[model samples]
Target: MKQLFSPRADRLLRGFGIIGAAALVLAATVGFALSRSDGTWGVGTPAAQPIPFSHAIHAGQIGLDCRYCHAGVEQAADAGMPTAETCLGCHSQVWNVSAQFAPLQTALALGRPVTWSSVHRLPEHVRFQHAAHIGAGVTCAQCHGPVETMARTVKTETQSMGWCLDCHREATPQSASLVAASHAQFGVEVPPLANCSTCHR
Candidate 1:
């Protein structure tokens, strides 16, 4: 009882001060990093898609090429969504009898697009080029993860700018050479990777 309050109060105040200082330091570091040109600090969380499409069934089991459904990847800046016809190719015959295929069939027959929510979306200002990345020998798994194994697609990477830059640095040279190599690896004429406008715009 001599000074039970004095020492305990002092220790508690010191502890609180230390925690506050640490929090300030952490926030400052994150703020500074984000202010840089790369704009990658305090990475955001990944998003979930609406429909649970299994890449394992389509990519691994059926041996479907990425371009088959994402038909615009090589030719366009964006990889377009699968058309109703694309889904009907398989579903119209096999899963046609299942209740699960009912909505798909209805959409296909009516010429309506599937309301597939995008799982990997960036900020409106952040420009990403699917063609450039694909041309660079960057596998789909690099960004999208090993989608071939996923029964339902889930975002596996944070998709932060830092992550993209790390891959770009590693694949830059390979991307340059991939265009020079024979197209036999990709089964199409290789595209060049020299245009900055191809990606930045």
Candidate 2:
């Protein structure tokens, strides 16, 4: 006995194979692209700050708390800029004797705020709350990228949504049994998981 095969069946099988291969290739490409993006997730690099400040000298050597300069980190939604008074606290006695402090002195004397450029600014539409992050146990180093070691601070992290969400998701707890495991992976207390309002507002 002779058996006959349908041409339609052969075409359908070939089509399905081609589609499967294409899907697999697309998925692999996406994964590879994500890995190569370098913590920015292909959005862009962090902004550069003005005045080439040294967190190493301040935070590391001098042992100033992050709150000294960023006074609002604990009290307000936005971490307030160091006022001229704050600068004068040190510049008055230290830089006051140095020619390098001339510009700072001039600004302080004029009662004008130092126009230091923001380094970690998100887009205008996105709002970040410093107090919330600090209250949630997010360390300054996690986002600021080891500021204590940076002499002239540079943009370290990409600060993209994916980066934020990845952190949040990893910290969320599922079951009480896994609480210790989750805390070990994340922290003792996780910040509110990356909700749209958390950053978008």
* Best candidate, lDDT: 2
lDDT of 1 by residue, 51-159 (tens): 4467899998998998899988876778998876787777767665666656566666787887777667687866777886677566787777777787866666667
The best candidate in terms of TM-score: 2
Worst 10 residues of 2 by lDDT: 177-186
**Residue runs of model 1 more than 4 Å from their true location after superposition:** 1-52, 169-201
lDDT to native, each model:
0.66, 0.69
What's the distance in Å from true for residue 170, model 1? 5.4
Question: TM-score for every candidate vs. truth?
Answer: 0.62, 0.63
lDDT of 2 by residue, 60-146 (tens): 999998888888888687787877677668667877566765667666779877777766667898877776667667788788777
Q: State the displacement of the C-alpha of residue 126, model 1, in Å, after optimal TM-score superposition.
A: 1.6
Candidate 2 runs further than 4 Å off: 1-52, 94-97, 172-192
CA lDDT, candidate 1, residue 199: 35
